[model samples]
Target: MEKPQPVVVKVVTPEDREEAYRIRIEVFVTEQGYPEEGEIDHYDAVATHLILVFPTSDTPRRAYGTVRMVTLPDGTGKLGRLCVAAKLRGMGAGALLVRALEKEAKEMGLSAIVLSAQVHAKGFYEKLGYGFPDGGVEYMDDGAPHVKMAKTL
Candidate 1:
């Protein structure tokens, strides 16, 4: 079988922020049943890299996936609000975005990178070398269970 083409990942520009928001709305709000407010939280307007992924297409490109990274006060990088569009999930978009974010984190000299992986996706993050912390905290967001996972940069 022929391989699917790769999605291009990049740091979103101001002009692409709205497109990123729309992608998040589709994945987190509509598909996951999260409230509109919950899906677009305060951090979105603050310190973060709103990463956007676009597939090579003939027509106007669409936002395929996105994730936000924030530098904490202590210098640890946190990845959150990750979402891959439903139709594009198996095309490796999510993994590509994560790898791109890790590269950004390394350049920032972050001590570690952490994220709260949804329970169903813990194994996915595990495959990326992230693991649950010993005293890891768990919580539910919009009814989905999540636990903290971290990897040293």
Candidate 2:
């Protein structure tokens, strides 16, 4: 058994946005059965997108995970559209993506960060210092069960 190499996560530039969307499409639309049209939305235009990439000698690097952060009107940061390539899910890529988003949120002077996490991933978010508001409640989003979680930055 061997440990997987760490990946570099960074804010996506104009040229890298496509790769971020690609990973989201693969994980959300194709794999999770989300509608193609709903996979992308207006938030993408204003949000700061982050992508996890494995360094390679290849000309164009591929993204293994992605997440986006948008500053709300109230000054809180919202994290959404988190996804990791199927093959890289258990390799800490998702956690790396989240930590990157948290760092970005703090840099922007946000008071807190929030996300609507899929039900199954609640524990994962909890481990990352996110918690449910008012004990715990579930809601439906994109036809999947999700819960709201927040962490102060």
Candidate 3:
């Protein structure tokens, strides 16, 4: 069995924002069937984006995962648009993205982080300390069942 490649997460620079967008397109738009136009939205203008990449010298730095955090009025960061390349699933890249986002949230002085997680991924979020809202309920989000989750920073 091959060991997973080491990955690093960095805040997406203005010039490299396309790298983040491309990863999101591959995961959400092309693979998950989200509308391409909707994949890039107004929130992107206000959110802080991060990208996961390999540091191998053999190839140019290419992003494999991406996530964003937007500070909300309630003093919480809204975590959204998380995606990892299909080929890299189960490589701990997703957890690293979430951990990096948590650090970003702390730097922004956010009280907590909130997200609407796909129902199937509830356990993933739970493992990262995200909990459902009191009396939480699942609802349709863009044709998929999702549940509200939050984690204190």
Ranking by lDDT, best first? 3, 2, 1
Worst 10 residues of 1 by lDDT: 52-61
Q: For candidate 2, report its TM-score.
A: 0.92
TM per candidate comes to 0.85, 0.92, 0.90
lDDT of 3 by residue, 25-65 (tens): 99898899989989899998888888888766643458888
Q: Which should have the higher TM-score, number 1 or number 2?
A: 2
Residue pairs with clashing backbones, model 1:
none
Best by TM-score: 2
lDDT string, candidate 1, 35-152, tens digits? 8977777887764554444445533345677888888988899999888878777667788888888888888889888988898898888989898885556799668788899999
Better of 2 and 3 by TM-score: 2
How accurate locally, in lDDT, is each candidate?
0.77, 0.85, 0.85
What residue pairs clash in candidate 3, if any at all? none
